[model samples]
Target: MDGRHSRISVLMFPWLAHGHISPFLELAKKLTKRNFHIYFCSTPVNLRPIKEKLPEKYSLSIQLVELHLPSLPELPPHYHTTNGLPPHLMPTLKKAFDMASPNFSTIVKNLRPDLLIYDFLQQWAPSIALSRNIPAVEFLPTNAAMTSFVIHLTKNPGVEFPFPEIYLRDNYAISKFQNVLESSANGIKDTERAVECCEQSSEIVLIKTFREIEAKYLDYLSELTGKKIVPVGPLVQDPVHEYDEKPGIMEWLNNKERSSTVFVSFGSEYFLSKEEMEEIAYGLEQSMVPFIWVVRFPGGAKVSLEMALPKGFLDRVGDGGMVVEGWAPQTKILEHSSIGGFSSHCGWSSVLESMKLGVPIIAMPMHLDQPINARLVEEVGMGLEVERDMNGKLKREEVAKVIREVVVEKAGESVRQKAKELKEKLISKGEEEIDEVVQEVVQLCRKKNRH
Candidate 1:
């Protein structure tokens, strides 16, 4: 190839999960349209489902390289991904991912990529770029608000429990933050470097959120990390429920009155406990609104759908409810006029989807950045969080109250209106930020000091 046509190539290796991988692919699509070449890497099992979903334009656009996750005795191939893995086994997966560094190093050496864009878990990636005389960036699919908060705390380790309400009201979240702090301070050997990879990068953190929503946080992040933080326009693609074509789902939704039914999903990962599921079931029954709720159990979870919920609960809401055992095409359902509200776990990606689609959120944040994301939704008037007890337990009555308020009551008209307004502003709007980010990335790559 001659110099005139040589395109700048970026090697992107996101963490082994759908939520982490999807946003990187969306950003890859935007980058490809700008004539940038991309080498997207992930485990084979994780890539299988999404490979077929790529559009024709993207068919040959990204070089999807499969990096086999080393199979450990404790966990098999399927367990490598966050979708099915139990919450407790996350540390095991992180260790397994770090063990694959030699494999990733081989690919980077062979490709000689101009830029290395890696997930927060793979801190060693930047070393490859350092060896090759180029720059690397840490691509965080997490929203800016949470990212900023974490970085700020990382910078100021002794800030007297910075966020009082979030930390005090939600002990689960506080505990998670404590883990992050302790881990960053002293995580295990393989992960300590990976977790701190953002600081190791050449002064640029590319996140899946824009400044319009969290400007203060973004500015604070820059000051905290001393890196030029770049906002990537909340890369939220319309959810394509791989199972949306399931004739029963759309048909059942069609039968319901407009804006009367909701699509309830707790994300692909984060399986609910039996107590949680039972409370949600009772709440749905009490809300008196029709819903299509998707439920998922952890890899080794022994409970059946019948065993998981309250006895006769299914029979009680027979016609009014549709319970899906696994994945559902959430985006397609949300697009349908029948999906008036989204009962979500408030994962950043899910939060962005609800915003982009104008579907109001009934936030029930389980852990991690979710609690922070939930607060942002309420701060921006996009959704209403279901109030939790001091123990951080989600109650049936509160669930019923919020669900009815968001989907079926006159009192929540403003919240509903604000959600739709956000959709129009985010989705129906121009691609100015989307287009501008590519230019910013190009400039970042062009900077001469990295090598």
Candidate 2:
């Protein structure tokens, strides 16, 4: 308390997924601006890319710390991260993570930071922090609507979600979500882990959302959790320095008309099945809209793009499409003048990015909170969800119809206008939310010192 102007130190621990680590890094960058020193912790495999992405200026304020997970038989050092991990090894990865609790405790003891900001899962993190008298808070990168929806189900079982607009009406989605909630790693269910993490937070829970889009959901979540829900303002990545990664795509986009092209990507972790990819390709071809579609395969997957896609699809679409494999500059592309709509898997981070960049979404929610997110997208009037058939299969015609309606049709004007309005609203708000966040965090640190 003596050095009042001294910078506060925080250690950020997100889950192994790229989606989780990304927002945490964005939040760390924001905190560094307000006189906060961040210790970004993760596995070595995950840290490598982060190190490359970090600019030279942040070398002092932001330091990377590696937490080594014990290598099991099938889980090697490289497999410690979930970026390109095989689906079946998920449980093993979680087991390895849990086993690393002792190593984390060692790091915590050595660093001895004022506060710990951890992601969902790993309730053990806060327990260790508490033992050492360090205040710990949970930072969920997921949106408020989905977070509230899951917590509601966990706390009040057998009750219907109050908001009818957001639901898993698709039986396939419902079954998958149930599996996710009931699924266990190291003898703890996922939902139970989430609930416990929220309960263990010192007083406040930080979420990656803004009040303009989810005021009611945030309020409802606060009521449900009995803790203040702090919206951290979307936490979208800054695209200023990411332009050099894919110049050809940017050059192609420059030639397109304003608000005429769609950018398609699922996410880093989830690889689309062959059938799913084929359907989307046909749909895109039918729509006649210029698009830049990014395709990804799992680690050790040798399937070529030619094999995965329909025959002659590449030559047929020729100049109208750009089929990029591996990765693209998502934020950079979304912010471009040519990208009007996004054909996305509706992952929470992607959803926030689209809204922040003022690009309307052609939501094709695949699984696990995506359907609910898609529903919220339509509810807020910022996007339209593509309709699927009875068995929850994506139809080519419906996909084409929604793509046309969202991007190139007269009916989509309202959606496009709404996207721009939301973007302006977010821009005007600027750093107001982060200012409030700083106050709340400082108060927590002070209270701990007083105790």
Candidate 3:
């Protein structure tokens, strides 16, 4: 090891889900590329997949440190992958963090890294960083709009009720059939705690969204925090499958008319139930459009797809559709010339990627801040949401109708055009300046440490 090379270690307790881990991993990779000796600390189970996914060259530069934690009761025994960390598991996760703080503190003290970057859910990291006088930064794995929404919700508690209520009333029929419970103030107390923790600590918050997209909200958040809101993102990589050969889907897509294919993926974590899967399959079949569908194997009784989908659904779609089971190159798929529309679970990353690639969206929000993302997409006039059934299930007919409207109907052309314009704004032929943002973040941490 040479003294010439600077070392920076990042400790992230991602919310035990793929959506959280993937963005953090991308950040870590970017930092590693900038000649930082990177140490990625995560749960032992979570670390394995990341290690497996890493290229041989990356493995040489990046070090993985696995922390042992007792199995979470909410997490099933077979659950090894990161997906959606259910809200009900928050208390258990908090307790785990409290328990791991001392161990993490010990590791930081021993390693003595230049800076510590953490995820939003890990409230204990800021306290640990403060104790050691090490500069820390929070990496939010969501868009600026959602981050701004969260910041506003923290400051004015009253607004949270109306936002979700308004979304439910205007977009989804679920709110009408079911008794929509207003979240107690206690529900967002953790967010307040996180903000307060940041306020007290000598750390800056680095959000993973662009200021160009959400300037006004970012400006307001910056003023409120009295800290810089650095939005350096839509952090994504070219869709290259390192482990496997490229699927012929891209070739098939290239043969089609420009912006004619609708790319459908539910992110890495969202698994559909069998009935839901069949409904979606039927809907796609009914729509009669060129589509790419990423399907995941069923997990449990909660949302099993094994029994739900009809026999030979894949065969039926045949040449018209491509069904990718695992690890589809999403970024590349979105960038494809044939991709005109995105039917998504409204994960922030997927939404940003679709928008960045200039694809209009049909948002089917499953849970979490998905509804919020859906609203933002719709407000921007580049997307539409499917109506939910009385029991909160998305029927095949509804999916078919929305797909037809977005992909087949004449009315969707305007939305498609608007999405393309937005894409042009984001994607440039010139060099991307993400490294500059990384350097700024590094410099800010150094300045904070000197103080």
Candidate 4:
């Protein structure tokens, strides 16, 4: 081994979604800045898009490790969009992890790295790293509040509440729900076994969130784990692309009154059904707010919008609205002056970006950690959740109500002010702190090597 070399391997099971992959990749880039060699592993299918976006300077240091899985049968007719994985694929992913563990073990042995950092879903990582005497850390792309909640749930089992229900309960009750979800999901049951694997093997749990923002919950988790819990985050930054400026939206925003526009994006991963799309469109039109709605084209099993939107919906909105299909420059859009509020699926990266921009949120959490994020945002008095019935179908009126609450009500102003304050705090810390976090990780790895 080259004693002076700062090398670490990062394994990520991307699970066919950009939301999961992007933050992990960002963390890898951050580590690269600290002179660490990163072995970025993913499925062959996910490599293509990442390759297109990666800058030339860092390309050599980031190595791609590809794993091939037998293609399962096509997704069911009703649910094939990017919003979520097919239910059957969960077991398939578990099986694939089991199959890949030995292969990953061989890679680690050959590379002989000092540390292994992996995503929450990679069940084999902790075991493989531990067997080789390397320290393993779990990188959660979700908010710290959710991480604290999950960790709490894992320690104290048996709490029953959906995300919204939990939020309605008192602050302490919310804490209990967090613990319940974590323990139930990562407890003695089938799902909890993987978390058990991580807890047993890992030396530390590294989360991507700020300690100042979620201090109470972080303290709770630190007490429960009896291990160091580090919060190294707001891990996302605006990608420096060379494309021409898309300032047209800003000009349109200036024409409108302040806080008049509602920005609707379900992130790159979630897709709306034709029926759901129509409902959203009609609801937006009914609400009479100037808006920007971003939607992706027919990819996977999503319905095309050639005939789905209400008749003359585009014409009626005219300069008042814009529909950006495919990729929209999200950071710039959120930073615009006239853009008043966000309607989001509560992806952590998006949540952080919105918080940094001081935009109030209309959170419509779809799956995974989203519901938990929604609860945190609302709890902090910065946002409101659009109520969803037990069936998971969102009504148009409810959408309208939440949008009005966030965009038109006095409560939203407090949320927006708090969000801006948080953003300023992050900025005051500067980019140098980000470098320090990555350096600390490298230092930890080097410490492991000496032993």
Top candidate when judged by TM-score against the true structure: 2
Position 269, candidate 4: lDDT: 61
TM-score (C-alpha) between model 4 and the true structure: 0.83
Better of 2 and 3 by TM-score: 2
How close is every model to the real structure, measured as TM-score? 0.91, 0.97, 0.83, 0.83
Q: Write the per-residue lDDT of candidate 4 for residues 176-292, one digit (tens) a residue.
A: 344444432212343365356447535556666776667776676667666566677777666455436555656666788877899999877666777678778877877787898
Candidate 3 Cα outliers beyond 4 Å, as residue runs: 1-13, 71-81, 84-94, 159-193, 197-203, 243-255, 300-306, 311-316, 389-391, 429-436, 448-451
Per-residue lDDT tens digits of candidate 2, residues 1-451? Answer: 1224468999999999898999999999999988899999999999999999799899999999999999799999999988778778888999999999999999999999999999888999999998999999999998888999999998899999898888886776787688777878998888999999999999999999999889999999999999999988988888766656677998999999999999999987788888889889999999999999999998788899999999999999999999999989899899999998999989999998998899999999887778888988999898998887888788889889999999999999999999999999988998777777788899999999999
- Candidate 3 lDDT for residue 88: 54
Residue pairs whose backbone atoms clash in candidate 1: 241-329
lDDT by residue (333-376, candidate 3, tens digit) is: 78878887899988898887887788899988876668777877
C-alpha local distance difference test of each model: 0.79, 0.91, 0.69, 0.67
Model 4: how large is the Cα RMSD against the reference? 5.0
Q: Write the per-residue lDDT of candidate 1 for residues 192-240, one digit (tens) a residue.
A: 5544787777667888876667777777677767888888876777555
Candidate of highest lDDT: 2
Taking all chains together, the TM-score of candidate 1 against the true structure is 0.91
Q: Each model's number of backbone clashes?
A: 1, 0, 5, 8
Prediction 1 global C-alpha lDDT: 0.79
Looking at model 4, residue 197 earns an lDDT score of 44
Give the clash count for model 2: 0
Error of 4 at 59 (Å): 1.8
